[model samples]
Target: MTHTPVDQADPPTPHRDLHSEQGALRGEHPGRAENPVIKVADLAWLEFEKPDLDRAETFARDFGFAIAARTEEALWLRGTFAGPPCMVIRRGRASRFIGPAFRAAERTDLVRLAAATGHAVRDIDVPGGAKSVSLLDPSGLPVRVVHCGEQLPALPEQEPLLLNFGTDHRRTNTTQRPPREPSRIQRLGHVVLETRSFLRTLDWYLDTLGLIVSDFLFLDGQRRRGPTMAFIRCDQGSLPVDHHTLALHLGPGTGYVHSAYQVTDLDSIAAGGEYLAERGYQRSWGIGRHIQGSQLFDYWRDPDRFMLEHFADGDLFSCDLEPGWAPMSASGLAQWGPPVTRDFLGANPSPAKLREVITALRDDNELDPARLLGLMKAMSS
Candidate 1:
């Protein structure tokens, strides 16, 4: 896979002193060992739209993200978190791409992660009070890390179909207070990937990035779902984190696996799902429970078709643990759902269809036609 080398932007001004020093995690600087007040806080992903920047921006706002800022090249979206930007939409003639970002407890940890992983880490200076380290994952999507932000915002329930007093006022259970919304991201959780070299990628993340395997799926020659799938956690805890922050599958080019966002509880998962549906967004998967992370899961497809998941009540660890190697099989992927569906993996968009759409957008002068068209056409053609 080839890409135009990004113009080497100036590195962000280092802020080694400002980070909260608490029970700083393992990879942090030796001097910052006592910094315990760390939060796994926030995550950022990509959404690429071919023809309309306005449409993409509108969808993001309607979906509960706050529009932090925009430029000719991209639009930065923020959730309730106090971080710079949790999501970004780069003007392009393509769909969504999930790029996962891992947080560093301190600047020293960033140094360690960059050195050990061989990922070129650069600081990103955003306008006003935003700062971050922008880098690329193995899959080539932009990923970044910055300070944590506020919690997810509270959205009102969609108006019921009938707004009259005569509407069905069924028996009310007044004892229960309305459920609380999901908490702000403590830090970015994990990202799953589908790659041709699953083992190699998995090993790279573990060896270079300091991620520990909580569990794994041992597969046979045919790639049929086996008995167990592997689970890995960051090597900084005793209680296993929502298992497997990053996962990979044997398949095609480095495309997204799935980006998992954390919420506070099961009620928030259900409430948020309902809230999204009422707001007229498309719900892709879930509203079901999962076997591995042990959370209530709900998935929605954003405008660019990236699968964004809302998970609540997940398993956590006391400390970073080792990998749990298990048999890889079909049945083990889910604890409960209708069945594993192909659409979830994004088998819908074929190469030809994507090319056609890109072509149409370029010809119509939609989006960043001049700058992005060349890249889109090359990939598509």
Candidate 2:
């Protein structure tokens, strides 16, 4: 089941040809090439601490994820459509980095490589007996894998409250004026992570995860846009597999850069951002557009200071073919928006504020300020 990287001398296989037999959904766009491997089935789960559970839950709901279930130790959230839980918050000691859930090819290659690489497969005892295999990628991000067929239904328009007044009813629809309704989570788009070793991590993902770099963000010493990041797509599905499922940023510790959730339209992005600001969630950057994926984006901080994004209309490549790399510059992140800001990348929090942020990530009893204060001082210096 373990797949060694095809020797570079052997040449890249025709990924589109491999997928021709799979019945994967091929977009109508001409630029996209057929991908034979991964299509994002759904976002499985994400782990966070429990103290910030309420804030996290509220943010997710407003951002369009529906609450599936909650316990003293964890929370399970899903999209509006029926599917396995997509987000999971576990009671944990570390607020740094957790892992990502991925749908794999029907073949056993990924699963075998995961075990060979020392990752473990375990059943998440949430509600549904969702099975997964967890292992670290070359860059150290925890990657979980499972075969496909775990598809969730799409959202249906059945809410009477969302109905027009008096068009189909004799009564006035007061629910419209009651409160803002959340847009539904349509699909998982991509995750961005910070790592000091960009190329090394990129190589690891390509060798192990069967991801191909569609495009990259390379830069100079500063944030000039070069291909420092890898936008990897699954190779087993039909053409133009879901644009990049993951992106890697050059930084320390496998911490979050951001996680993108796809929504129905641009109006949802504007409405969602307004809702977050009214609730006092710190707006990081955006309510703008990006140069690469071209999603209308808005970024914000969770109670733990993790970044979550609401995006619409990302540019989809027709194929997984390498489109070449660009130099990394701060200006490259957005084609047109307020210039890239520090807070948007989460580098501006004072050490004390960051400590409070992490403290909020813990359960009711596990917080310790003395230890956190020391860690903060070290990071600040």
Model 2 clash number: 43
lDDT for residue 30 in candidate 2, whole number 0-100: 18
Model 2, 178-286: lDDT tens digits are 2355656766677877664555666566655566655554333222212345566655445555556777755433456788877776666766677778778887888
Candidate with top TM-score is: 2
Q: Which prediction has the highest lDDT against the true structure?
A: 2
Please give each candidate's TM-score.
Answer: 0.62, 0.70
Candidate 2, run of 10 with poorest lDDT: 22-31
Q: How close is candidate 2 to the true structure, as a TM-score?
A: 0.70
Q: List all candidate RMSDs to the true structure.
A: 14.6, 11.3
lDDT of each: 0.49, 0.58
